[model samples]
Target: MTDPDRPVAIPAVPRPKDRPGRAPAPETTSTYRLGQGPLRLPLWLRAVILACCLVEGLLLAAPLLGLGSARAVSLMLGGFWSPLLGGGTGLYPGQGAVMFLTYGLLHAGLLHLAMNMISLAAVGRELTRMIGAGRMALIYLASQIGAGAVFALMQPQAGPMVGASGAVFGLAAALVGHAAITLRRRRRSMAPLVRAVALILGLNVALTLLMPSIAWEAHLGGALTGLALGLIFAILPRRA
Candidate 1:
């Protein structure tokens, strides 16, 4: 074949601005809202938690005022009264199912009150954000009621031990449940959250085992109840 002269080809387009900039201004999120959604939490939940804690504390101290009748008033009526759970130390219960529930509000000491209030402060606010305040209240009540049921079952002849441990435990479980659901729904792994819960549970268990002063039994009972309630809430259909 005869050789033919041909012009060498050259590139046509110019390389335009491919230099990386400051990450597209970071998606410009709108954070300044006049107000948050209605589900954000009304003052009532906060008020109830604070008011209940305060009143319960006062009731606990009322016995020091030479008012021996305070105990009777608390049990017969309401507000932080330890119900006789029919253990070897106390009298037998003579009321309906509410005794279990009633005992939930009754705390043993300032430490008990502080523990519960701290849990409520941390979990209640966040839960109200996820579910509504009404739902949070329901969860708390259900967890307490469930714990009482379990306690009565476990110790049919146990004493009348009272506290908000069950309900707070429920809240803690709900917090874990919420985190799990949120992570799953967002298509993320739950390993971190699970590890966190596991760590907390381990620490608590160890502390209880080491310190005889702590009510390890009540805490365990409450935690189990709360876990059940949290699982239920997670799977149950939300009302429209």
Candidate 2:
């Protein structure tokens, strides 16, 4: 018998074993869990999507709000017009320089906005994860600048270009470039990357033929810029 004032020593209970015909529950760990959801997107990517949506929303609501044709107003104020590069007066100060990046926020319609936003979300997520948000943003800005430069040089007389397609193409190119570098480093065959390039070019050609109004030049510019940037990033040494 135990003393009344002494602490009782309890017997250790045996651990439960897996029941017959039933699997044991998975052990949860610090790194991951069985039913954990995917990680959320970076802040910058969300901000870009939000900004684009807000711009499009305002344009859509302009008419209902009795503000006249806000779309045209937006294009005039923010669209990338080549003539502006040639000393053309703008509706606002610094419009010529501002249009390069600003045009990405303006979309022609809901469909246009949806497509671009989808592509942006997809590519931006991967890129932000790979190189971080700051570098991704830099690449985006560089791509926009490249697109604007090419458009200004190639389509001097063309109408105002407004869309995020150029930047999207750039991000896609960056992904491709990085993939190509990785494959090369692994001493893998280049056939897959070549096929991807061909596919992209084929799609561009088909789209150009179908929709003559598409800004193919901008896409080209953005792709080239992103590819260069991606190659440089891949070759750079990582900081300790």
Candidate 3:
């Protein structure tokens, strides 16, 4: 017979989900690796930014190569003109719509080109990561068109307008909308996003007032469109 004073021992349960020496898996998120910064732009984002830069370079170099004034030709062909779109100029139909997209490729000068490329780089990387390249394309194109329409209506006599400021401003506005959605998800206060939006808008206003040549209407239009689309993205479920 066994000894009555003998003690029984309990066995330890093994955790299949975790191992003794292994680290936990990293969290999955729709958010991009923003900590990596702009240098980590994906393929599509890099393509778009590089295309703009190349186009601007070509426009600048065209004149020197005796290509018959690329800037003048670009302004005449692609620049958004209210009169031309409205049939006042009796040009081609739907020309204004074509120019809406093309005008973004044109720049007033080196400074204008540089500013737009920088802005695109800053915003495009994060946005492309968050929304994917395809959605980003939609937002950008929609912003360009919306801004063009607004500029056409607001400044019918403001002369030909050419630049990517509208699209750039739209990207900024979209970030604000994205920030709002992010704050909601984290159950955090939205005061920071609100402040940022206010600052951006205020800066736009100041620039518009100080610089007579700036097309504030286009910026406003693009921003509104971007905000709308961004909110829509935020509300929808994540997709592949």
Q: Which structure among the candidates has the greatest TM-score?
A: 2
lDDT of 2 at 117: 94
Give the alpha carbon lDDT tens digit for every residue of 1-240 in model 2: 645555454544455888999987665423323344565677877888899999999889989989877888888888889998887888889988889879999998998899889989988878766666777788888998998889878998765898988888888898788878988899999998899889888988998898898999999999999999888887875454
Q: In order, what lDDT does every prediction score?
A: 0.64, 0.84, 0.79
- lDDT value for model 1: 0.64
Residues 153-231, model 3: lDDT tens digits: 8887665888888988887778788778978999999988789888887988887888779888999889999989888
Could you estimate the TM-score for every candidate? 0.68, 0.82, 0.77
Candidate 1 residue runs with Cα over 4 Å from true position: 1-31, 35-44, 60-64, 68-94, 210-217, 236-240
Which residue segments of model 3 deviate by more than 4 Å?
1-39, 89-93
lDDT (Cα, tens digit) per residue for candidate 1, span 24-122: 323232333333344434475566566658767677778798775675566554432222344322333445455655676666567777777777777
Q: After superposition, how far is residue 162 of candidate 2 from its true place, in Å?
A: 0.4
lDDT for 4 (candidate 2): 55
Best candidate, lDDT-wise? 2
